[model samples]
Target: VKSLEDFYDMEGFRDKEFDKDDKGTWVVSSKIAIQKDDSSPLVSKNIYLFFNKNNNKATGKFVLSKIYEDFSKNTENEYRIAYSNNKIELLDNAPKEVELFLKDYKFLVEEKSFKSLNNLPKISSRHNDNLPLYSINYLIKQDNEINKWLQQKYKFMKQDAIMNIENSGELSNSSLSNFYFKVRYKGKKEEIQYFRESINFKPSKGGY
Candidate 1:
């Protein structure tokens, strides 16, 4: 876990770049997903690794961090830590509460992709809502945890779903097709409509 060999041998590392120090300022760069949070709804977090001039350890590491409340969400932020002069400093302006948690992340090399089962959405519960629902838009009505997990899973499955939509014939839902719904939001009745044909529906990218 302490040597460059251990790092290079780890699994599920997608892309990589390298450079040598004394010869050309040694560096190794790659991308990986690491579960660096427990309290956060996010489980699979993107991490960018950069190791320059030091092979035994990395010189720069960044984590895709999140800040969310109620239904509003943000994951664009990144928590960065860089190694310099034999010391590592948390460089990103993460919230004070999250800043301290970064200190406990995987400091050593990981042999596998970090997966957080606790945070993963239970598919059964997610799709079992009494109210009729379609993909992302319907998810917003769900609670915070389900909302976060739905957005996360949708981000991964959107392309496939789009392909299905493209190949499939006749998009119709009983509730949507029949146009029979007495659904209300916040005690106010809402009107529902359905179109005979379909258009490429792209859910709001990410932030749900």
Candidate 2:
């Protein structure tokens, strides 16, 4: 298996150029470009795929680092994937995984089954100081309610509640500590919340 360092140093990975100080945690671009009207524009996009080297897991922090509408004008537009931890959320559409889940398990859950849970309250605070104090009661209750509804409707085996936790490194300044969620269907053996200390969430009104 390739190491994380190898992945980071892979060919075609170029450091992103941004004006702001917050240049993202990790970013890289491709050398390919699209051409238009006698000019070779930087039309090709750069995608940053973040993964856990130790656990060999992927995260939702994938970003389109650079985009160009015209080669003559250096108008680079960056687009981000609507993210949760395990899911790649869309801007105006539901997540592809969620949609697949609905389609495959139509016998298990309806397409609109989770519509109500969609309105559940999200983590509103951006500071870790408020997480412990901030109530997850409503969120848990809502999830449980959905689980119960699914059980009643489909009579499928109900599994233990599984949650995604971001794990950070021991050193505060280590860039490798930037970890996100990994999905495991079996049990909560590795479900310990890791970076709950540094993370601050701004929950969306709808899906996040």
Please give each candidate's TM-score: 0.29, 0.22
* 1-208: candidate 2 lDDT, tens digit per residue: 1222233222221123322332132321112122332323323332233432233332332222223344345554333433233333333344453344323222111122335534554433232443222223223232365445444543322553332334332323333323332111222332111101122111121122
Query: Candidate 1 clashing pairs?
Result: 19-27, 20-26, 21-26, 26-53
In angstroms, how far off is 173's CA in candidate 2? 31
Off by over 4 Å in 2: 1-32, 54-57, 60-72, 82-208
Where model 1 places Cα greater than 4 Å from the true spot, the runs are 3-44, 53-58, 65-74, 84-88, 107-208
lDDT of each: 0.31, 0.30
Using TM-score as the measure, which candidate wins? 1
Candidate 2, residue 103: lDDT:
35
lDDT by residue for model 1 over 34-94, one digit each (tens)?
2223334432333343442223344445555444443376565567676544334687676
Best by lDDT: 1
Q: Count the backbone clashes (under 3 Å) in each candidate.
A: 4, 0
